[model samples]
Target chain A: MHKFANPTFFMKIANGIFPWATGISILCFAVGLPLALIISPPDYQQGDTVRIMYVHVPAAWMGLMVYGVMAASSAVFLIWRHTIAHLVARASAPIGAVFTALCLVTGMLWGEPMWGTWWVWDARLTSMLILFFLYLGYIALGDSFEDQERGDKAAALLALVGSVNLPIVHFSVEWWNTLHQPAIFGLKGFSVNAAMLQPLLLMVAAFQFYYIAVLVIRLRAELLSAKIRTARFNLAAAE
Target chain B: MTRKRRRLYFVGLGLLGLFSATALMLTAVEDNIVFFFSPTELKARTVAPEQRMRVGGLVEEGSVNKSGGTVRFTVTDTVESLTIQYNGILPDLFREGQGIVAEGRMGRDGVFLANDVLAKHDETYMPPEVADALKKSGNWHPEGATAQAAEAKPATTSN
Candidate 1:
């Protein structure tokens, strides 16, 4: 684990897997889209509109899952002083933000036709919205400081603080009466029909692979920018 | 681990724990959380009178009566039922035995005077799933399931 903490070493591993991640992501989407929209049964209540669940549910799950990754990486960075962990956390913020936003926007589109409202401040919805803002906050704070390490530490701390929202988002339906439905897949076990479950799970895998592919690109960019900074500093010292 | 690394762990855990405590407390005490209350919760002391809120449960079978633009219905958690009156067009998804949420203030007469009434599930799912679990205790009448049940079977009706 310590050996893998070097960014260059990690990049080599990431690059090796990058092609596979993209290939699998595309394959999942290819199968998932049809499975979700065509093969799945029209719901007794929602009819064709139920197809939106394929996108909405996976996006919501990824948004939370990505944030969990970010927080854990931040903890690793803070405790072990692994700069690679900070880079990983930094790379994850925008992806998490986009996923959270997708979840919210898709939620609105699904909500309007179904729940008769575009938005509600119910605990689940509000907590999810906060998660979106937390991502934005992390991104902004990551770049706010003049020193990169200072920015990294600041963002890492925010990620840790924001993690409290994870459990709240998961349990808000049960702990408080929320307009949002309690999750179908939970510790009690999945009650959803297998047909719907298959497509949803596939879409979730697609989203996760998508995140990995994008994260590698982002991490590489960060590493290059750091390299450029070091080169310019070396040139100045010689002059 | 180095002493500095050990100290970092302690600080991180402490901050995480503090934030969780604050969030949990805030969620527990906030009065504006107008998410649904079971009919029994409405009948009891948890909710203050006339404080605007949303009540949710299955629309009792045979209890929905629409007259002109106003629709009157009973929302039952099976343990108890609350009568609700809404003076506007209900959403297309509103049906007997379907889970419905209505937002409005209660009256001195105990009726939930709803300004807005809507279905709780998207077209494909049912909210009364949670309510149905409560209804199995005996007071829940299966009669009046005249409205199609909200369960998510494949679309069986030809449009």
Candidate 2:
């Protein structure tokens, strides 16, 4: 576990996987975009507007999944005092926020045409909006303290606390009277037709790879900043 | 105790307090949840005028009326019904005898004045409550439940 936390070792692993992550993600988008927009038949009810599902569903999944990653990494940082874990949580915040924003925006576009409104304060949407705010709050809190160590710890704690919103966002439709429909992929079977399912799953995979590629890049940058800080300290000591 | 252990305890307590506060807030707001009501459920309770709520079920046969830009329709579970008035273009999927959900509040005159109406994203999809209510009303015939048949049913009923 300590070996995995070492910056040099972690960067080696990140560099190795970076190329594959970017390559597969680009391939996925290349295929997924066309299939989602053209090949797949429009919903019998929704027509062309249903095409938005490809981007919206994947973004929503990433918004929740990235938060989960941040939360887990944050817990590891808090428990084990691993700087890498905290760095990871910090790096993921903005990406998660972007995905959450995409989910909201696409949802609005779809809602206006199909649900007949651009927004509603319903369970699913309200929880998702809150999730977006939580990401923003975490980002801001990470830089609020003067002490860098204290700021990192506080941000890790915030990430852990904010994780409670994830389950609420997911189950809001089931637990409350919500405007959103239940998930398409259920325990029983895929609720959506195969034609739509293919592109949706591909887009989800694409986003997952996108996260991995971006995270490694950011993690490398974080490590470089840490080295620079140490070098600055050394120069001051020499002075 | 070590400083690290003390810090851990503080964080543990903070999380506990935060979670409890969230739980309490959720409980306090429970009544305002406004679950989707079938027309039957809507009938059983009195919703105050301008209180936002959702009513979902099948659009009643031969009930949708268009005049200029305004549209009025009755939504039903076959047992009870609510009149909805709207001044907007309905979703492409909106048709009589098809499952839909409308979000709005009661007008002072008792009619539901809806600003939004939602139809299922797919023909195969039916809001569970709408299906249950239709079944309860003994009017659920799966063979004729296609969107095309739904479009035809209202016209035939009008004739």
Candidate 3:
């Protein structure tokens, strides 16, 4: 793991993985969407609108999952001072942010039909909304500082602090008398029937792969950007 | 702190000011953020005095009574039911046994006078709060659900 922290070695690995990840992401979505939209039976109750779950639920899952990854990477970067770890965390933020935004938008679109309102401040929704804002804040804080290392450290710390919300976001429906739904897959097991579960799982797996692909691509970009900055700084110093 | 630090301070202050303003705005619109009401809560606490607030729950089967432009219905969380009155274009997804949230206040005579009605958009999804209430009521059923059911499915319907 430490050896992989070296930028040159990390780049080589990312180069190899990026294409496969992208391919898998494309394949998963290609397969997942239709099955989710068409193949799955129109729910006995909800009918056709059940299709949005293929997109909305996966996005929400990724949003939370990516944040978890970021927080973990931040811990690694802070503890080990591994630049690659920081790079990985940095690369994941925007992708996670996009997923979070997608979840909110699709959720609202779904909500308007189901809930009869476009938005809600219910704990789950509110926390997710806050998660989106936190992403923006992390990015802004990362760019705000003049010292790049300072920026990374600040953003990493922010990510760590933000992790505190994940559990709350997850359990807010349970802990508080909330307007959001409780966990479908808890220790007690699933409340949903298998007909719906199969497609959902496939989409979730596809989303996870897509997340990894995007993270790899973004990591490469961050590496290249860092190299360019370093080269420019060296040239200026020489002058 | 030097002059550069002072400038940074100002920048931080500006950002903080902007953030604070946004928080205030969200706080002000807080009332508008919630979508539905459980029948139990609406009937007992929020609707008894006929408070003007949104009522959300499942549209009770056999309870929808269409009267010209105005539709009267009952929303239930299985434990309790709230009667809702709405005079508006209902969403295409609105259905029986589905999750719903309606906006407006409680009216006199123990009726929910809704200005807006919302339908659940995803299959198997309940508002987190509603789901909890259901679980508390011991009405929740968890069985034979596959992987997607791991997360709450939005209670969505079609147009």
Give the candidate number with the greatest DockQ.
1
lDDT of 1 by residue, B2-99 (tens): 87677686976787688768777876786556577789877775556768888889899899998998889898988999999999877766899878
Between prediction 1 and prediction 2, which has the larger DockQ?
1
DockQ (C-alpha) of model 1? 0.28
- The parts of candidate 3 lying over 4 Å away from their true place are A177-180, A188-195, B1-39, B42-51, B77-80, B120-159
A120-166: candidate 1 lDDT, tens digit per residue: 88989999999999999999999999998888899998998888889
Please state the error at residue B107 of candidate 2 in Å.
Answer: 5.3
For model 3, residues B30-115, the per-residue Cα lDDT tens digits are 44544444676554553345455666677888999998999999887778888889999988768776667787876767787888
In Å, residue A188's CA in model 3 sits off its true spot by: 4.5
Query: Order the candidates by TM-score, highest first — what do you get?
Result: 1, 2, 3
What is residue A31's positional error in candidate 3, in angstroms?
2.5
Residues B15-124 of candidate 2: C-alpha lDDT, one tens digit per residue: 78987888788778865664578888887888777688888877888999999999999988778888999888788668987677887898888799998788744323
Tens digits of per-residue lDDT, candidate 3, A36-114, equal 8777666544556667777887888889989998988887677667889998888999999999999999978776665
TM-score for each of the candidates: 0.88, 0.83, 0.74
Residue-level lDDT for B145 in candidate 2: 44
Residues forming the 10-long window of minimal summed lDDT in candidate 1 chain A: A186-195
